[model samples]
Target: MKMLAATLSILLATSAAAAPGDADFAKGLLKKGVAFDTVKGRGKVPAYAAYLKTVLVDGGFAASDIAIEPVGETANLHLVWKGSGKKPPIAVAGHMDVVEADPKDWIRDPFTAVEEGGYVFGRGAGDNKFDVSMVIATLVALKAEGFKPGRDIHLFLSGDEETEGVTADLQAKQAKAAGVELLLNSDGGGGGLDDAGKPVGYSLSAAEKTYADYTLTVVDPGGHSSRPTATNAIAALAAATARVAAYRFPAQINEITRASLVAAAKETPGQLGDAMRAFVANPQDATAIAMLRTDPGSVGQIGTTCVPTMVSGGHAPNALPQKAALTVNCRIFPGVTVASVRGDLERAVADPAVKVAIGQEWVSTPASPLRPDVVAAVTKAVAAAHPGITPTPAMDAGASDSVYYRALGIPSYGVSGLFMKESDAFAHGLNERIPVSAIAPALVHWRALLTELAR
Candidate 1:
């Protein structure tokens, strides 16, 4: 008995001493993730796929553990790590493709994977690579330690998330076919600590709005500019754009937003929490909504957003355009379908002369089904991870591939055990990064969440 107790004590001490090394491994993974981003793989899906392969290999992913399934123009890779059967498998998902960046705007080469002043600078650093590296390093360390998960773990890596969400959608479909119990995608924003350094509750995305694009076309009889009709196509488009911008849909208080507001109120002091509560109680209150709208992070909760992204319709300076078109992208709320948004547009424009047609761009699923299992599991797990931090069930304003699964009636949740200052973390911007301190603890949180859900 003494020998056994002595051996256990030594093992525990060794584990404690070795824990700090995990941070170093995390740094190594960050280096690899930044290196992966160095290749100009945006929109080059094949290159993105190649990059993922290199990352998986370099990150110590077993060959048999990761498999790439190609769908038309997307690649969905399923990474499986066998477990000890104590729990089922949970999926950790993220996209490898980053939005395009201009080299001139960056302080360093956006693709160079530069590590200076504690930041591993790169294009996809915050947008996703950070989470990806964190997961890889955690799992690799666990595997090396002979730590089999209580449940099977799957790491789903999708290419072309920046271009479209088809890859993740397809991958979710495949997982559903295999009876995947819990699907967790690390895409939605994480919990941010407030000014007082208190951790704000994490956001477990139960839903996300649908994304739709529509092109407004204006046509007139061709003629010289000098003899043009009173209404120019561009002029008409400008008017249409103005009307769309002016159009305001009624404010809504959905389950997710309500929860988000209440939780936020608790984390904040004085006016911030009061403001959040006021907004939650009556989103229709003009003053409350206006106040919340001032914060870009909270604006999406008030309602959906429509932005005019592209416009084209002109020939020569002297010749009046025969046709003109403007494309407007709308992020439709979950309860409202594309059809309803179209109907709303029809009413907003109230002009038979203007033709509004939905574009043929890739279709995305609505937010994942807000199933009871996922909500309960995530809420419990988050609470366990950050005591006193009340997580809010929320709908992601931006679309994630989980929307694809939700559309198919498969419940998917976006939960990452990491958070940072929105201003400092550059995702889809220059100098994207995650704090090195955030990595090790996040591993513990993720492992716990996965274990809980799998069981």
Candidate 2:
């Protein structure tokens, strides 16, 4: 029990390394994907989908099996690889869209992939594109090698995952109607390498936090700035935001978090490790709670977190603002309702003048149960690809396309193939990139999964 569960398993499992395919081709696909600028409102996702379709078709997939549906300026791609099995289709979840990136803030053009040192630098090089390219390449290779499956395999690529999830929402409905067995999301959950270039371990996300946004609004009669009243809207809004900021959601524990924390304790050092063990043994330990609260990485694991992300007021420089609003975004823990979090925010402000409103319709979902088939297959595939790395099950804090699928009562797991060091991750930051060397084993990973699960 001194080492983490998966960490201990990782050390016990050693095997021959997995064989790779044309990694150079996969790298080329990733670079070409980076050039598309698939951010929202760009009207480029359909074009990107077409390029992928060409690759798949040329590699042996039938062209008629792929459909590109335009949703507003963006699009969704759905592909079906038919089989003879009686079981429902297995789905692979991915997104073509990238978060908005400003080229001025980066050392290289965010849309242009540049290979420097041993990495590829671009806006989406690491986040979803890296594994996305690998998945596509693996499928193509399977088709070319005349590999067939017992059950139909579906690949769904959403167009607006970084902004609105309209595409994923639509895909989830269609997948449910068609009776999709489960989804393997490439958006989150993967392995981490320590600074020494040694594999620490891998994590497969069986659960995730819910994403919701709330607005705190205050309105007042406009007047001259020099004659501002005590009820200035901006001042009242700021105070309300401050209260919500200072308030902390009660510490909570679940099956996934408890296991994840137990694993983290073994790798963590000093007082943090001590606190992790203490909190695991007793969730009500005040000293452990206080110590864990001091760490941002550990704090969110213990509770729902709400923070003011945007605030605006004052229309004119010479006049008092007539209205002001604070936009607070929350990553609600699983099993917590959105309305309950809204209630908490309103109570924290405790001001009649300030109004808290849910900005959109969002649903909180329960964690997906750990299916034995999924866990065993992932463990086997990872051991084959990474040679000694055992994947850990976790509940990630970020929301992904899996959220929609999981909400619809479908089991979804994050099984991204790309693995890298913690420092190499820059999914939404400047100089965003990923190592070029990750392509081969990633190819092996996807191929192995499809071989076992689909076959």
Candidate 3:
């Protein structure tokens, strides 16, 4: 999910090793959250925020310390757990809304959280609700235990991350005014297991590519289908989109991608792995670039990527198209301006008659400088799930609400507690889920991160 006025949005999983009672509580929270159907246009996010508020207030949080403010049809939930010492707040962030999933396309009702064969299946189960539930439950349990941190801890939940990011933009300014020192986003960054259940290094997303959507349009005078015309809007639109599809922005790299690529190279096998290493050593390696481009997983990490996602044309089949349009979404490399990406798209279209304009936009932020304390906290947390697993720094291809906070100068880290196999991830897709066994360890992970960092 990205469309920063230039690049922009998006987020999963768990297992056991800690308290089963608390794990069950988290699962309950998740099931209840899933039942709400907080998808955009549903107008249900406020109700969901109300439910979450109850979870906090019932678990010992004061009602005054929490607020549910409406943003459009959705709402944001902010909570504070005050600590004894004087320091800028340490925040934990995530989104309340999830992408739309049709009931007909899923085996189970996409909104119903179903626990099946050690997995919980639902739309937001893996993408975000899993981690969001864990964070909420952990804070509740910590409060009950009377564990006080060294500074105030805050929770910032955005109403719409899968579509527009307005909630996050507003929240970041509030966080800055409140003097937030750093943020731990539960939406991205986590450990992964191989097919054999062995650890594949944990990732701490330090940066993300910019996301934007551009609209390309062609317009012409309508005429009967029997009357052939050379300046047909539909034909011109098709050609323009085809050119955009064939276009490729130059390959690029930055601190986080460089580290992530090298780390990935060590784990990946064969020619792809070699290409990763070569590209890192020399970004201009054409052979390495070609090889990397062949794999979708490796491709976005190396450079900017754009694809035509949506299209529409004539009103009726019998009439020649009066207008035709396409929406091209792009994930731009860091340090690149939104205006620059728009310029590239305009050049690719290369048709002066074809209108090019912004369809959607969002903000972009640089890679957060690695902080030793954050690294240590995340490492210890990851170890709770997989002993000796050291998390590596990464730049996520998809943007998150964390980008908004980063734009404001607060260092934010994606330190999701869930450690899952890549094959198991299904955030914005059908029948999304996360393993049940991953829960207790995540509870442990959050507890470790909160206690260590807040202190």
Candidate 4:
């Protein structure tokens, strides 16, 4: 009887160890992430801060270990977990803020945690809340298993990343000062399905295009509407806009993007994969680019892109305006600088009648080299959990908080290990939500990554 009881106890422990709280814990954290959005402003700050407090408490972390550091205008919440060994810590970070979403547009309240059709629908569900929850879930599960990391693990969740990345920037500076060895920002861009619905994941963003806003001004002396003035301000602005629309920043391959394209090519299917292979094998071939350009995804890999976003230059229906302007937002390539993009715009609108000046510059530093240690850790973890999908090193065309750490010379990967299907809210679109099926696999991916990297 004694031996039988001991055997039963061991089996119970093993089952608990093997099975992490996939449902209750994830649901609880997802609810927390969604509810905290209410604390966006006014009383929102305290509300969000309180939510973090709840997360730390529920995750079995001591309140004393949770530190809130105020940087400039915003404060970053830090949760530190000490491991058994003495190695430097790896920082896993995510922003707490969610972009404004119209409640009317959503089928359910954007702030309310809605579990319907195997999805948790909300504003930050895919963009970052999902990642935030993943970290909490892993930590909670690890704590239950009495699993201590060999290295100190610091999880930093910033207050504001939606508007500007100021808080995230400050957090990176602070992390580096505190001696964080590896930084992972889980803010934007990740899982997408191929045309056949096969899950494809992008790991460690190698490079991101910098965002620069250019304002083009065309000025003409005001004249009566009946007189039909020549060379009107609106007309000049339109001509310049057309020129910019027609202009294309020449294609040039950078180190990281080239590596990413090669990896993606290996994974891509059908003729697209063939063209990708051909381009990587021979970049000089004009046909490679022309063929890749036929598909939208490949165009971003080889070029700097520009799109005219906003225009404001008209005065009145009856009067010819004296001044007109349009805003052109450009996402510059990795090797290309903001100055080079500006120069390209100037050459495109060379007519003396138009004047161009940079309005707002969001500069992104070049990507860091893929650290083999981190990559191998993530790759091993992913392969163990998902047999068929091979982890690939890639670059994101969209920007993320990862750029801030990369700027500080810290090895950063935009890794969440969460598989998200293609959806608009993945960035700034509506009805954004992560699927239920992805939740379990993501947990396994993150858990493996944490365990491997901690060692």
TM-score of each: 0.80, 0.88, 0.86, 0.86
Off by over 4 Å in 4: 1-21, 42-45, 70-75, 83-86, 193-202, 225-231, 266-274, 423-427
lDDT values of the candidates? 0.70, 0.88, 0.88, 0.75
Best by TM-score: 2
Question: How well is each residue in 81-105 modelled by candidate 3, as lDDT tens digits?
Answer: 8887666688999999999999999
TM-score of 2: 0.88
For residue 329, model 3's alpha carbon misses the true position, in angstroms, by 2.2
RMSD of 2: 9.8
lDDT of 2 by residue, 193-270 (tens): 888767779888989998889999999997999996878899999889889889999988887888889999998999
lDDT of 2: 0.88
Comparing candidate 1 with candidate 3, which one achieves the higher TM-score? 3
Off by over 4 Å in 2: 1-20, 103-105, 220-239, 312-324, 360-363
Scored against the true structure, residue 395 in model 2 reaches a CA lDDT of 91
